[model samples]
Target: MTKHNSPLLGSHMSLSKSTNYLEGVVNETVNQNANTFMIFTGAPQNTKRVPVETFKIAEMNQLIDYHEIDKSKLVVHAPYLINLSNPVNETVWKFSIDFLLEEIKRCEALGIHLLVLHPGAYTKGSLEQGLQQLIKALDLVTDYESPVLIALETMSGKGTEVGGQLDDLAFVLQQVKKPERIGVCLDTCHLHDAGYQIQNWPEFKNNLKQLLPLDKVKVIHLNDSKNVCGAKKDRHENIGYGQIGFDTLVEIVWDEELTTVPKILETPYIDNLSPYKKEIKCLLSRSFNQDLK
Candidate 1:
């Protein structure tokens, strides 16, 4: 076991389901012993699109001050409708760009340092062409400030999604002139589904080191996969409840190289927030007593 703390331990909590609003959610998460946290700024479903309001920013700042959550420990998930790789007409592209820009601005205003986004799927074009489109779309967006890091999440490589592979993600980073403005949010479940052996500690670490530098890894989505490795399925199961066993999580919790990053659980919280608390506690209890050989 390695005495690791690179990623501050936390879980994703839904603000829409809570009665206490964003501030209450932060308080509850902090009370639960989370040093880091993730939240959806808008409704997850495609109901009425809610505009990002200024009051939300004020509330978020208040919560941050109350909880003392370092601005770096907080991350916001972008809306589900954004797809930079969409090969649709210019109208769809324009809508996605606007939506993503607004999300970036909201995150920036609230003092959140990172915003995790699913690099959109290419609907009808070749994968290569779609990737180029993604780069182009990112280039066109101007709402994000230099301080805000737009994190492109690794996908499950199920279809025409442009970010399943490390090379694909690197390609996007390479194309964008603002390299410092881009970062990565690695999801364990997605990596597993994309055929990475996350359960093997040495392999996992080496793979990441080869694919990306530690500095570029700004956030981690610590999820267990409901699907088998290489299945390209996107189902997220409770930690240790899916194909990703408890041993794998033990390795992750104790890994020395990742101790400083923000590892937020994206697990299913169907049984209220109790399951999330349990998951965080479980990881915290791991023995980070020695280095991995």
Candidate 2:
């Protein structure tokens, strides 16, 4: 059995739909005995946002403090509607930039510093054009100085998504004007789907380091894929039941380089119930739950 340096383990908790919203998020994190968590300020699919004051920040902070949850690792995900790579339409691209900027402001006000964002799809344009547009959008949004850091999430290459490959992300990082405000969020399922051999840690790490630096990986989405490697589908399964097996995921969770980085589970629910409590327990115990399904 291997031991971790008390890694930050948590899941994507709800912020808007629950009875207590933000407080419920903190409570849910505590329920699972997690040290950090992620949330969307509103719904993930919509642009509609409620006033930040209504989030009950004071109450949420008190709950976080009481539970000794690491506030620095708390994350907020941008709405999926934001597409920074919409090269075909200027209107859509501008809207995406504005929405992302607003989300960053919201995160800053809430005292959260890390924001996870999908790099977005090109749809009707070439990958090169999409990458250019994405770089431009990021530059525009990060022009202002804020404590909030935007983490570009690795995509599953399901469609015309921009971040399915490391070269694309590396190019964006190299071209982006505000490097200090940008970072990366590595999702295990996405990497596996995009055809990266994540199960082979050494080879994958060597290849990854050749293009992207480990320090830029601010967060990790600890998910198991329902599809096999190189499937290009983004379906997520429970920890041990999916293609990316339990032992591999456990290895990632305890990886020395990512020890301080936050690991968030976005696994599918079983029987309309969250499997995080059990999943987190299993990961901490450094063993797989045979009956997790």
Go through the candidates in order and give each one's C-alpha lDDT: 0.76, 0.89
lDDT of 2 by residue, 1-293 (tens): 11235678999987774558788888878778788899988878887788999988998989987777778899999999999998999998999998888898899899999999999989999899999999999999888789999999999998899999978888899999998888999999999999998999778888889987889999999999999899999999899888999999999888887788999999998999999999999998898888887
Q: Per-residue alpha-carbon lDDT of model 1 for 123-147, expressed as tens digits?
A: 8887887788788888877435547
**Where does model 1 exceed 4 Å of error?**
1-7, 45-63, 142-146, 270-273, 287-293
Residue pairs with backbone overlap in model 2: none
Worst 10 residues of 2 by lDDT: 1-10
Top-lDDT structure, candidate number: 2
lDDT of 1: 0.76
Q: What CA RMSD would candidate 2 show? A: 2.3
TM-scores across all candidates? Answer: 0.88, 0.96
